[model samples]
Target: MDSATRVQESRVFPHPINVVWNHVRPADFKFWTSAVKETQVEGGLPGEVGSQRKVTFKDGTVQRYQIVELSDLAYFITYEMIESNPPIKSSAALHTIKLRKITHDNSTLVEWESDYSSSGNETASVVEDSRLKKKEALQDLAKALGSK
Candidate 1:
């Protein structure tokens, strides 16, 4: 098996940890995440482990994801892709998000990372595309959090 491609991005929000946590909920996906046209929970309850969601992008591609890990007290969550429209050929793809409070200013640092693999010959482009998309999504998140 080939090693998965990985991308990580982080942003510091001036808002406190609790505020950032509220905005990061799965229920609020479409509100702050760019490129998400629609999102609906397909199984279980939102924000809980084992919960699944189908997300449709503006381009009409769809992806089904399940929350594999969550810890409200730790301010962390992880999700794995279960299905995708274009069909990701990889064995697995996981997205993890973590939040930490910057004690001095009482602000929060948000870190998001994705580990994924592409099928066949699309690995390079797929990795690059995912990185750019993640960057855009983070920018949108920062804007929604009122961070400059």
Candidate 2:
């Protein structure tokens, strides 16, 4: 039996729920994060469940992910990494993101979670590095959405 590693992070953005979840969920990741060099949706329509996207990072690492589940009403999406490289070359990975609107402040609370386990020796570090990237992405998205 194999155990999966989990990483979770939450950030509250100073934007409305619809703004964060629907209006600006990064149609182009390259516009939101400098870490991502490019992203191309290769299957189905972009943002549709079952759609697959190949993403190239600034470091030249590439990974492909498929949208497994998505719910606009619930404000959540689940995806899995079908292909990856290097530290995660041999790994099982799934990620889920949830959002909730704060009615009082008109803000959105984002919860991002990742479950994965790699066969490589750097399994632990790989997950940690992912956390760092996720954190940076949140900051970038905040900036893009007009937050200081």
Candidate 3:
């Protein structure tokens, strides 16, 4: 399987690592998923690793994700859709979100990525399209978090 389509954007926020994590981690999700009427469950503990949650969209699309790595608030989370309303066939694909802290006085930079086999051409296109929307949503999230 070839690498999945990738789209990434990062922003620096003027907030502490945990503060930034607290603001961006789940709250930002609310901005993204809630807008589309999707809500993510609260399952992860602050600064702990291996925590997880599920997100369900208004259309009944669902993805189960977990925090796979952590470094004192900086971390990475991964996910693959377990179910969807239209039934995503490329269930083998994976998405990873990396969060890194910026040293310049209480700030953090975030990176979001998705990967999967090349056979998922249609899924790749859709993922590409959604990445743009994600970027827009992230921007809104930053603003809402008072990071902008």
Clashes of each: 0, 0, 2
TM-score, structure 1 vs. true: 0.90
Task: Tell me which of candidates 1 and 3 scores higher on TM-score.
Answer: 1
Error of 2 at 117 (Å): 2.3
Candidate 1, poorest ten consecutive residues by summed lDDT: 25-34
| TM-score of each candidate structure, all chains considered together | 0.90, 0.89, 0.68
Please list the C-alpha lDDT of all candidates, in the order they appear.
Answer: 0.82, 0.78, 0.59
Expressed as tens digits, the lDDT of each residue in 7-45 for candidate 3 is 566666666566655544552266564445655554666
How far out, in Å, is residue 81 in model 2? Answer: 0.4
State in Å the error of residue 39, model 1. Answer: 0.5
Give residue 99's lDDT in candidate 2 (0 to 100): 94
lDDT of 1 by residue, 1-148 (tens): 4666888889888999999888786643664456889888978988878999898988888999999998888998899989999876566789988999999999999898889876666667767777888778878888887777
Specify the poorest-scoring 10-residue window by lDDT in model 3: 19-28
Report how far off residue 71 is in candidate 3 (Å).
5.2
Quick one: best lDDT, which candidate? Answer: 1
Q: Candidate 1 vs candidate 2: which has greater TM-score? A: 1
Across 1-148, the per-residue lDDT of candidate 2 in tens digits comes to: 4457888888898888988886334344654476888889888887788998888888988888888888888898888889876446336889888899888999899888988866646667867887997888778878777786
How many clashes does the backbone of model 1 have? 0
Q: Which residue pairs overlap in candidate 3's backbone? A: 4-116, 15-106
